[model samples]
Each structure stands twice: as C-alpha cells, then as structure tokens.
Target: MGAEHYPPPWFSVAPMMEWTDNHYRTLARLISKKAWLYSEMLAAETIVYQTGNLDRFLAYGPEQHPIVLQIGGNNLENLAKATQLATPYGYDEINFNCGCPSPRVAGHGCFGVRLMLDPKFVAEAMCVIAANTNVPVSVKCRIGLDDHDSYNELCDFIYKVSSQSPTRHFIIHSRKALLNGISPADNRRIPPLKYEYYYALLRDFPDLQFTINGGINSIDEVNAARLEGAHGVMLGRAAYSNPWQILGLVDSAVYGAPLRSITRRQVLEQYQVYGDSVVRMYGLKPHIRDVMKPLLGLFHAEPRNVVWKRKVDAALLRCTTIKSILEETLGEIPDRVLDAPLTEVPSGSTDTFIKAKSLLPPPYTVSEEELL
Candidate 1:
C-alpha cells in the first residue's frame, strides 16, 4: 500500500501494562473517536499457552477499531504463533514493545528493554510477525539501553529492524531505559527526554513514520512535535489518568473531527449499560467498582470533583450493583449545570466546537432517591 493510503495516526493512547485494558480502551473510545487505541502488552507466551481463552485476551468491540495489539516476548516461534492467533481479531496494527523498563518486564520477561541490546534479535522477531500476519507490524522502543546508549547506536537499531522487515512505523519513547535498580514509575520520571533524538529520526528516515512518546501532556506540546515533523503522538498516563479531560479537546485540536457534544454524565450512563452487558456476557460477579474503575477521572476538574471521587470510593465498599453506584456518584452532579457556563473550551474555539456545543441536550436532573 502507498504512503497516503497508510495515514499514520494523528494521536494515540499508549499501551500501558495494567491501565490500558480493553475496558479502558472502550471508555477512551467514548471520549475520542479519532485517537488510535492500544491493548495492554500481551506476552507471546500467554497467547501460545492459553489456547482455550483467546477471547478473554483478544476480544474487542468494532468501535475500538484502528486499535493495535502490543505484544511482548523474545521467543521467535511463540511470537509468530501469537501473531497468527491475533490475525482474526481485526487489529489495524501489531506492535512489538522494546521499551518497558520494569524489573518484571526487563529482568524476568527478558523481552522488553532487554531486547534493546540486540537489534538483530528484534529485527528477526519483526520479520516473523510480519510474515505471519497481514496487518502492519511496528515497534515501540527507547532511544537506547545502558552501554548501547548512543545516537549512532539508536540509528543503527532502527535501521537494522526496518531494513530487515516490512515494518515502517516506529514509535520512539525519547528516553534511554535504565534496566537496573529503578522502579518503573521512577524510570518514567527520571530519564531525561531527548526528543531531539526523535527529530533526528524524522530527518534521517524520510520514508518511515515516527510517533514521539514520553513526557508529553499538553496540546501545544503535541502540535509542536507535529510542526517539527513527527507523524503522531502517544500519550500514556496523561491520557489514562484523566482520559475524558485529555481526549475531550482532541477532536477540535488534533484530528479536526467534529467535536462531540456529549457530557461526562451521559458517558457514565452509556458506560453503565455497556458494563452491565459485559459483566452478564463474561460472568463477572456484578461489582459496581470494577465497572466504574475506568471512569475514575470523568469529573476530573469539575467543582467538588474531590467530593465526587470520595463518594465513589466510599460507595465501592458497600455498593453491590452498578445502578446504586451511579445513583450515588454520577447523580450528585447539580442540575443547574444545564444553565451554568461550560468550564472551558470557551467561545474563542473553532466553529466545529461551537457548532457541536449547540447539539448538547438540555440537561435534566437525576435524584439518588428517585433513581433507586
């Protein structure tokens, strides 16, 4: 396929280990239709060993399309088998992770940041995956690891992998991985982001599409990278921690898709229904907290948001059903918000935003007592 036909994603949510699960991706889709979503990194071993429950691992709704399945493992045969198994899931892309710095990932799994030491191994893995599946194959990597941490070494790694396989997309987290004695959270914070490395990647490989990741939290930063020639941006904690607030601006700011007029409360109601179906279908014991975990940041910056969060946290202790949880937490939003000014995304925004605002339904009240 031609370059134009394979348009790189404008914005994407990163494949965080425990956080970006299918449920979280589903919640994110409710926020932005344009942003590419990713699954939590699945080990090739898990896919190869667990033959009977692929649905628990690979199942996703069509609305989560343009999603990528990120796999982590070094065994070539198992990775190939995992790629073949993932083929029917309809993923738009398959990503190999070579950037994780967690002890469990690098030390125990020996596939994540450990692979950064052997670009040839990664190249071979990519070739196997590409040969097994028709979906686009890609890699996410750090600039370098320990002794191999050099600008030339980074270039060499990318050159080797891209030259050896059909892979054209490389998402670079602009930080070197410290494989020893650092916790994953600290690793994310301590590494000095060398985005200039990414700029050089864009300049050196005109034929490849590169998305920059790490320490990017704002729209201005995203646009700045785009202006400097990045093909896309991948957000992890910033997107997952406050998904609705971050993705709420993406339609107007990034993709220029028509802004959605849907409110957070409306999203909660929809999520409730979706959660009910998921639990019933999967035989998950009906727990409101499990269903509501992904919606933790929906009311992020609103007034009394702390009170709302506290209410939810407290409710989780006793609330047995989703209906009671929604009534106690989401039902707390004041009806007067219908008349109150929107807290942000004010009148100076684009016409699509303004036009979309006109589509919001007149807000109605929900009483906890009445809802029950």
Candidate 2:
C-alpha cells in the first residue's frame, strides 16, 4: 500500500524540451531531493551539428543531482558519441527517447518511436550504449508508432531490446506516437487512455523493470499503478506545470524520507534569488524574463502583470524586481499563504488563515481570470 514498499527509484519527470531546462530543474530540486529529473531531450544530430560549442548542450547546474539525460535520435554512431560526451558530466542515467512524434523529428529518419518496425535497431542501439558506458542505459518509448498498433509488436520490441541489454530499464509511454497531422499535445490525450495497456505490460514482461508514463496524475493514480506491478511512474505535464505535487509526493508519498521541508514562501524566496542570479550572470538582459516565468500565476491577477508576463517571454529580457509584479497584481499575497509552509498546510484553514485564499490556485499564485 505504501510507496516505499513498492520499488526503488520509482518516479521520474519526462523530458519536456523547453519546459524542463535548468531553471525548472533547480525549482524541482528545492521540492524533492531524490526523484529522478530528466533533461529536455537533446537531439544527437544537433550536438554533432554544432561546430565548436558542444559543451553548451552538455553543461548543467550543480544542484540537479539524481538527473538523467534524455537523447533523441536513432543514429547509433552519433548517439554513442553523444553518450560518451554526456557520461563525464555525471549523468545518473542515459535514456533514449523513442516516443516523440514531431514530424520535424521523424523527417531526419531518427527519433526512437520510429524504430519500432526494426526492434533489432533499438536493441542494437541499446546494446552499443550498454557496452560502451558504465552508467545505466534506459529507453523511453511509446507503446506503438506509425500504423503499428499491436501490443504484441510493442512487447516484441521490448523483448528484443531487453534481450540485447538486460541491464537497461524501460520507461513505457502507453500512447502510440501518431504519424498523421495530430499535434504532440493532442497525441497525449487523443489516444484513449487504457492504463490496462500498461497493466498488460506488467503482466507480459514480469522480468523487466517497467515504468509507465503519460497522463498519470495524483498520488492515488500512482499508487494504483504500483499495485498493478509497475516498477515506477513517470509524470510529464502534471509534474511540470503543478510541480509542487511532485515535491509533496517525494516526502509523504514516495521516500517517506524524514522531510526537511521547504515552504511556499521559501519557494518564492528561491525564485527571487534565481531571477536575481540570472540578471547578474546574463548582464540584466533577456534571461531575467525567462527566469521569472514561474511567477506567471502570481501576476495573472492584474491586467498590467498579464502584459508583463507576455512581454517578458524572451530568455534575454530581465525584470527590475518581481516585487513590483506582486504588488501591482494581487495587491499583496496574504501573509498566511505567503508565510505558510505548504507541506504542513492546515487542512482547510488555508481559507481561514490566509488573506487572499480565494484568489490563488492551490498553493501558488492566484488564478488568471481574476485579473485586475
């Protein structure tokens, strides 16, 4: 029943290209110290294509421990090269992305999802990485791709990859990656969620350590999957957008690690520091606006702040200070919510103690509709 009794290193964040960059990873670390955080998938060709600064793609901040690097590409030689460069950076795991459906990705004849037709290629690629790297090699794959909708095909591919490199773990994304004109966002929800497809995966491959991803929300849902014999749960948008849920899960739901807790106020404080650091390092330029994005819901309360959010969209723009954004928008965050430790929030007394409980979402800033 308890998460601890379930498995080791069970939950992870799927790599979202722009969304899961260093700034987000820094924020995620402040919440959960142990859950595995994945990088936005790095294109193997992109790494090779850049003439001089491959290090630009490789560098990550120090705070992002227990991290995995997700690489998208089907080219074995180039992937091996990228993995060689990535390994020295202290990546805890190297994951091959086999599920992204962007036509841009498929146009190059790479992207792991398309490798489904030739399970041998996926297996050979995994084998190459496993043989060359000392670190654990893993795969993140959709259940099927193109017109190949058979679960048997999926299992066949999984069996091949596992047969070649049993040391590698598998992360199964239950939806089939679409080839038609459907966008990737729709691909997530449009594929009818048959968690039973994932449950059947556990039934079929009892020898493998399988982690299921896509549309998994809430601790209860994760608990149900673990009961079904999944080795872990991988959360994508829910973990990225609402994030604090993942933090809460790390302590209460997953590790039961004696919580050295950080509060919502502390999170806000950290953001202030982060934004300031960006300004300082990037010379008060576009990076500040990029860094201030987490404050979106906060400023959504006011008309001017809404404009500020959109105007500051570039990675090069910087804000003078977020205090102005806060003051101009929601007046001032209620002292109770501002001061309260979100982890130990008193049942419903958030409403009783906080001054502006109705305006904010759950624990972060206020809803956008109430703009001033």
List candidate 2 stretches off by more than 4 Å: 1-7, 279-286, 295-332, 344-372
> Which candidate tops lDDT?
1
Taken over the whole model, the C-alpha lDDT of each candidate is 0.78, 0.66
lDDT of 1 by residue, 1-372 (tens): 212343358889999987887778888888777788889999999998987878888888888877899999989999999999988877888999999998888997788988978888999999999999887889999989876777777887888788777889999998898877889888898877777677777767889989989988766566666755669999999998777667877776777656677777667667777876766355654345656778777666767677877888999898766667878776566654312322335323233223323443323233353234
Give the CA lDDT, 0 to 100, for residue 328 in model 2.
Answer: 47
Over 1-372, each residue of candidate 2 has an lDDT whose tens digit, in order, gives 112322366778788887777777777777777777889889877776763665556667766767888887778898787777677777777888788887767556656577777777887888777666677788888888767876666766777778666445788887888778788788887876545556666656667778888877655666656654668888888776666655555656665567565565677677667656554353434355555655554322333544544544532233366544444433344555445453532212222112222222222122243222
The reply for model 1, stretches above 4 Å from the true place, is 1-7, 280-288, 336-372
Report the C-alpha displacement of residue 224, candidate 1, in angstroms: 1.8
Candidate 2, position 321, lDDT? 61
CA shift of 298, model 2, Å: 8.0
Model 1: how far is 27 from its true place, Å? 1.0
Global CA lDDT of candidate 1, please? 0.78
Per-candidate clashes, comma-separated: 0, 8
